[model samples]
Target: MEEMSVKTGVFGGTFNPIHIGHLVLANYLCEYGGLDEIWFLVSPQNPFKQNIELLDDNIRLEMVQAAISGYPRFQASDFEFNLPRPSYTVDTLNRLAEAYPEREFTLIIGADNWAAFDRWKSPEEIIRKHAVIVYPRPGYDIQTDVLPPRVKVVNTPLLEISSTFIRQAISEGKDIRYFLHPEVYRIIAEKKLYQK
Candidate 1:
C-alpha cells in the first residue's frame, strides 16, 4: 500500500498583519478548493511592493502563526525567508515541489492578481507546473473561461477588509478589533506594531 498524497494550496502574501478576512478565505478554500492543507507563505520581501514601513519579517511571521494557531489544516511557512530577496511565487512553488514530492501544490491568488498574471516571473511556467485557485476580490471581475485549464475561479464571499486598512487603522489608533483574530490583534497591540 502506498502512502496518500497531500493536496496543498500555496497562499503567499506579506501578511504584515494577518486578519479575519485572510482567515475566512483560507478556511473557505480548504472546503471548496478541495485542499488538504493551506500553507501561508509569509514573504520576507515582496518584489512588486516597496519595503517602506514594512514590519520585521519575524514579527510578521509570528502574527501569522498566532492567527492560524488553532487550525489543523492551516500552516505558516517561512520558506521564502530562507530564499534570496524579492521572493517570487514561481520560485517558491518550484522549491516546494522539490522539497515535498508527495504534495501537490496549488497557488491561491486573488482575482485582482489574475488580471496581472502575465507580469509575474515566468507566469507561463507557474501555470504549467501547478494548479492556480483564484478567489473573488471586490471590483475585480474574474473570467474563468479565459483562464487556463489548471486555473480555477472560485466564488468565495468577498471580504473587502485588507491588511493595509488594518495597519492604517492601527497607526491612527482606531479600533480594528472586528477585522482581525483576537490573538493577532492582541499581539499587534502588545508589540506596538504599525505605529511609528
Candidate 2:
C-alpha cells in the first residue's frame, strides 16, 4: 500500500517573538482543523505589513524555534528565506507543494486576513489550489457564505494577545510572563528585544 500524504497546516507569521497566543492557535488548528502537522512559515517580509518595524529574521526564527520545541506536531519553516523578497503566501504555498509532495498544505489565517483575502496575490489560485482554515480575531467578522468551498471557519479559543502588544510591554518594562511561553520569553529577555 502506498503511504498517505500528511495533511499539514501552513501557519505563517512574522513571529517577532513567538508567544502563547500563536501557540494556542496553532495547537487548536492541529486538533480542530484535523491537521497532521502545523508548520510555522515565518515571513522574512510581509508586503501588507511593511510599515511596521520588524526584527532580524534570524532572531525571530530562533525565538519561534524555541517556542515550538516540545510540540511534535508543530514545526518552524524558514522556507520563505530561500524564496524571493516580499514574501507572499501564494508563492510560499506553490514552493511548498513542489518541495514536499508528500504533504498537503492548508493555509491558516485569521478572520481579519480573510476579510482582505481578495487583495492578496493570486487569491483565486490560492483557493483553487489549496485549503484555508480561518480562525477568529477580536475585531474582524468572517462571512462564511461568501468564501470559497476550500475555506472553513472553526471555533477556537479567543487568545486576546498580539506580538505588537508584547513588544510594547517590553518597551514599557511591563511583565509579559502570561503572554509568552517561558522559553520564548527567556530568549526575548536575554536578548533585550524591543527595549526602547
Estimate, for each residue in 1-196, the C-alpha lDDT of model 2 and write its tens digit.
9998899999998887788989998998888778999999888865556645599888889999998999899999999998878878898999999999999999998999998998999999999999999999888988878878999998899988888999999999998787999988898889888899
Q: List the residue pairs that clash in candidate 2.
A: none
TM-scores of the candidates are 0.95, 0.94
Candidate 2, backbone clash total: 0
Question: So what's the TM-score on candidate 2?
Answer: 0.94
Query: What lDDT would each prediction earn against the true structure?
Result: 0.90, 0.89
Off by over 4 Å in 1: 46-50
lDDT of 2: 0.89
**Candidate 2, residue 68: how far the Cα is off, in Å:** 0.6
**lDDT over C-alpha atoms for residue 174 of model 2:** 99
lDDT of 1: 0.90
